[model samples]
Target chain A: MSDGPAIETRGVTRVFESRKGFLFREKTRTEALKGVDLVVERGAIFGLLGPNGAGKTTFTKILSTLLLPTSGTALVLGHSVTKETAWLRPRMGLVLGGERGLYNRVSGRENLRYFADLYGVPIAERERRIGEVLERVGLTDAADRRTEEYSRGMKQKLHIARGILHRPEILFLDEPTIGLDPKSARETRKLIRSLVSDGVTIFLTTHYMFEAEELCPRIAILSRGRIVARDTLDGLRTLVGGDRTFEVEAYGFEDREIESLRHLPGVSKVASEEYGPATRLTMRVRTRETTLDDVRGLLPGHPELAVRERRTSLEDVYLDLVEEEAT
Target chain B: MAASAPAYTRARSTVASLRLAVLQFMADPQWLIPSMIAPVIFGLVSFELFRGYGPYFLIYAILGAGMMSMWGQTLYGSGWATGQDRNFGTLEPTIQSPTPYLYVVLGRVLWNVVSGLFGGLIVYAVVVGAAGQPPALANPLASIALFVFVMLTLAAIGVVFAAFYVYTRYAGFIQNIGEFAFYVGTGCMFPVVLLPFAVTPIALVFPPTWALDALRYVAIPGYTGFGWGLWGDVAGAVASTAVYLAIAGLIFRRVERQVLAKGNLSDY
Candidate 1:
């Protein structure tokens, strides 16, 4: 509701310390987030892509005011998440959905009704709003069915319904489409778009590269508790090297042939690695001037060489950044 | 300062939570079976022990049995629901809502009092059946009202103990171990005046101990639990219960902050 960014963090960190041993207790502190800084604008579907244990959920939990950061600060709607939770909770929603997090014995409608009251939905429109969210999530038919009988996809839809039932200004969805079928995942993505169309800022975390590329105009890649890169899709495409890559494979390449391939037009960088019995040279080209034929021409001595050109994708950028951080 | 929900909002949430508890109880009434076991056993055993002592002794047997039933249903029932929340993974979403979790506990305890009264009636029937007659009360109406008031005091205890469940998932196990200790310490099955002087201070800390003592004064003829009589015990009960209610908010705030810091809200 403020003019500032919808979500922002400054050097936020979270460490989880657990104790073991009944008598001489031993402490184990796992730093889940290490000095992460991020900014998300309003009305944007900002995608956060990270591998397992990469701190995506931790950062989201901090931003949503579900967990306090061990150090630094996080602001949602320009209010401190730790200090101003009362103002933040009503305006924000979260979906940490699974088979759990639901009243399995109650009907989906009943679950929404309970949350509608807790969220303080207007008495005049509580039932109507629940109906709208259920319809939007494609669960009208299953609305009265006990949630324990719901399929994984149906339960997920119900989770989404409860999250948007109150119509929060921002929503934090951690892997909303994780366990859904292909069709269901696509429909979930469509729902995300519709939510953004309604002017709700979305902080989405997922492992689906294509989903992030398709939905988020801006994205961030988190690796091992740290954010390695954050930018527009094209911006991330540029970060790893360029917008195009050519994978040239041959049994082996001579020193001169490898050196000559690197000098080709628009080639910004060349990386070599063993692929099965052959050696693959990955050339990152920043321009359209380089073609597969141009690469084949340079290595004519090896007629068996296979040249494959692929446009740079978010997945490529993600792997490159995460690996870069790892090394 | 954090913004507080409007009074109406809090009240509505509390009512909604109470409704949810009722709905859940209706769906699964089997939980009532375990809570009934202890009270029925106590009623039968105490009736046998107090038989033929005196006409007033039957009053002790009945009040002691009813108090045991109300004790479990009010304190243990409310806390168990929170343990179930941890199991259902409902704790996190409920905690995340703008409505403070304390109101939710209040709602559940309110419903428990309803169920606990049902439990108290069942125990009363069991005792009367064992004794082959109903216990005579000097003032039945005042005793009934005071008995209901004693349930409210037990509710204060419930709300306070519910904070422990929110603090740790293992709270149910600890409560299980401490259940008998709570009964003996609070003197739910006997008069606190019979306890050692050193232990009386600890027993008086629980509002139900004083409230039950006051209820006895009005229920039993020639009964004097304390030298000052019914009004004195009533004063003590009201003051102690007020203290419990006052500190519940502070305790819940600290527990909530601790769980959030530990990131253990979802742990079961």
Candidate 2:
């Protein structure tokens, strides 16, 4: 076992040069990844969550040694990411985006065998591992089919198989379930869990929060090339600083009632919406010993009110973080 | 078997990649099918028209058609295939793998050569049987040797063209140029003997030209029958093919490095 984290980055930056035209006069520089530091513990399912164009792919590329960072340093399994790529590449498997990473002309079996060889997998063990991965990814039946005829999901599964061919110490899956049906997406998540159980660490970048909530034990929210939050799902919930919000609908239409609820001691933010025949009010309040007690006390005054407390979820926390950043 | 050390892991991986390349070619019979048909089409319609001139015409057509098959299917075919791979970004996973880049390139080039050989044999059969003027082997063993050298040379040429496709982004242009060169240099319609002495020397420098004459001496009807010995043509073609192969190999390595350094391999 390694003493440090499976993946670690310190002030890593990846800058890409955009050269335009034949003469090469017009040049622009875009910083895809800017001085970012992160760490992933061994055997942990880590999620990198970010909006589109948030440099998640750039960060993943640098960490996987596919692209060299302009500045800063990253280490994968105690190997310098920038230097010693040949030694480092075999130990870390990567699944890039889209179906483009695979050879369409070969059968899935042959494709896997070819990649296995590139990873230096022994011949005797190659077939065994290939069989295991194909079955694990539910591609055993289609293994002999040419990849050109494979559907998007099948190609992605094969991509995953190729990534883990050499049993790399750490796996980097970028948008692994980007274009998959619900069933396939769930299966992919299950596969990730299975890999983690096998002691293979996973560092994944996904835009789907449910994926993060369902798969990643610890998640990092990357916004604008920086990590705004990195914690367990439960920790993120606490960090958002919002408690269970109740949306109450009452038949009685009264402005004074709304005013009184807004002035409650624990209520931090109040939002109101129309609920058919009644008014639906949502309050984001700090949880105190008497918070529910306070709501209960106010509810009795309005006889027509039907009070229901809504459970705060990961999505709610995510929206809160996004809205806070917007302000 | 007892457990062995991991020294041969890389070699096994290279072989596996080569197998994958072969699998890719086999998976798409459409690619090979057309290459097989092109040579026959040229042989039937074009080669027959040139037969009245001399035995040299029939032999030249046969050899030219054979070279065309290899140059078109192997060299130009590899160019188009590699271009497609680059456009699709399939090279990313390949380059990222631990296998040396040279093995990757060689595996792909070898696949082209295999396809080219198949195409050459099919064309050779059509030209010899259909034209009713098959060229005899000047020295059967030497002819076989020349075929090996010539195919290797053509495969190397294919590597160079594949590299060029990475930069041009239009591999079809290479295929067109290759087809034209096949017709002109190999004297498929006009034998180099019809050209002036100065032009003959220049045309003879092309691999296909040398290959056409060599095949004619051994496989076709003209050269060995006319006092030009089989060994002379075989040796000359072999030397020229060797030189072409060496240059092609250098170009393949150079372009590969440039493509990797510029990160243009993934460019569509």
Candidate 3:
């Protein structure tokens, strides 16, 4: 083990060049990572949250040595990603989601054994480790069946089993439970928690806010190739500065009614969208100056407005941070 | 720590890769059926067409079909396998493994060569059964040794072809071109002596041409020289095999670096 942060990046950037049109007519450059710096301490579940095209996958690729940064430096387990990939690759694991990573034609046990060999697990311990991982992922009964015949959730579990087969120190998981059923997703979360309890550091990325809040003590939100915010759940909630949010469900409110609500005293932000049969309106107000009773007092005499106070959640903080960066 | 950990891991990885190649080949009917049937069909057809020239012609056809089988399998088993890995999305995972990528590829090529040799033996059986006699050899040991060497030479060339296939999206086009080009250039169906005068030099550069010529010299019993003497042909095959292996190593390393730099390992 090296005496430093488990993972660190300094001003890392990646630019992808693509050409389009006939006979190479045009060249376009997309900067996927724009001079970002991040650090993950040892033995922590660090969550990275982002929307589509936010460079989360590109960052994972750079850290795993699958792609080299266009500029700057990234170190994993104290070794340079570009110059020391051979030394660094063995100590870390990477799990990318979707159904394409495993060998569909072979049995799960065979796939595990092949990866064990690739990771150079000792011959004496290969079978025991394979069995243990299979049991841990709840794939023991299905381990002998061909992977193609397994359900998507089962295959994802097998992917997780393959990632931790060598007992790597740092694991990079990108959307591990994206399409799983509720039960399977919960089980997968349990597996991740157990992995953390065993002292393995996890770098996770997901769109599930509750999953992040439950698993990660610290989280970072990325938008448009930059880290917009990094802090704990409670810390991120403080970013809104003691603003209370109220939700109103109504059927007859139009753009005029929304404009009226925006002009009310103590209200800072008003946003609305269609939800089911009613239009859902949300307004953020300074909690020290406004109360739920005061909000109802300003509503139009249209008898359909049903109002209630909403709790602050990580999703609210995430949306606030991402929406701020977009502007 | 075990003193033999490095060697043990390399051997284990090689075996694992070999197992994967064999399983994939067996599981896919598109490759298995054609690979098993073509050489035998070609061997029988050639024997029936050339029965007037004596047993030597039968030997020629068998050996020709044998080399062709090896070449075809190299393209399909090694080169096309890499393309399939990309489509299956397993290419990145394999690259991410702790084992060196070169060894995994070499193991796959080795399986193709071995499987090709097995296919060649079947072709030989068909030739002998159809002709009612086995071809005599002037130096049996030399013929056997040369046969093993040629398979290895073809494996090295296959690795080079696979490197190109791994990096490019035109893998199918390359496989088509490589299969037909080697069949003609290596004189798989006929002697290079009958090819046009200008084409012989181009044919001479490929190791398979020298390999086939060397095999013919020892196996045909009363055979006479064409371009070089027996020892010269043998030496040429050895030298070309070395050169091809070196080129394969360099190309493999270059493509590995380029793909990592470009971040296109999973691109289909």
The interface RMSD for candidate 2 is 4.9
TM for every model, in the order presented, reads 0.95, 0.81, 0.92
Model 3's DockQ? Answer: 0.47
Q: For model 1, report the TM-score of its A chain.
A: 0.95
lDDT (0-100) at residue A265 of candidate 3?
Answer: 71
Q: Which candidate has the top score in TM-score?
A: 1
For candidate 3, list the clashing residue pairs, or say none: none
lDDT of 3 by residue, A1-327 (tens): 556887899999999986778976799899998987898888889999998899999999899889989999999877898898777667778999688988888889999998889988878899999999999999999999989999989999999999898888889999999999999999999999999987788999997999998899999998888988888877776665434678888785767777877777767778787899888888876555676666667775758779988666778878978888899
A176-195 per-residue lDDT for model 1 (tens digits)? 99988999899999999999
Which of the two candidates, 1 or 3, achieves a greater lDDT against the reference? 1
Assess each model's interface with DockQ, reporting 2 decimals per model: 0.46, 0.30, 0.47
* Tens-digit per-residue lDDT, A1-327, candidate 2: 457888888888766676787877889877766678888898888999888887898888778766667788889887787677777777788998577877777788888887777777777798999999899899999999888899888888999988887887889999999989998888888888899887888999998988988889898887777777788877876777556676677765467777778788766666677777777777765666436557757767676667667656666666667666556
- Model 1 in CAPRI terms: which quality? acceptable
Candidate 3 Cα misplacement greater than 4 A, ranges: A20-28, A241-244, A249-268, A272-280, A285-289, A300-302, B1-8, B29-31, B222-227
Best by lDDT: 1
How close to the true structure is residue A304 of candidate 1, measured as C-alpha lDDT? 83
Which candidate do you rate higher for DockQ, 1 or 3? 3
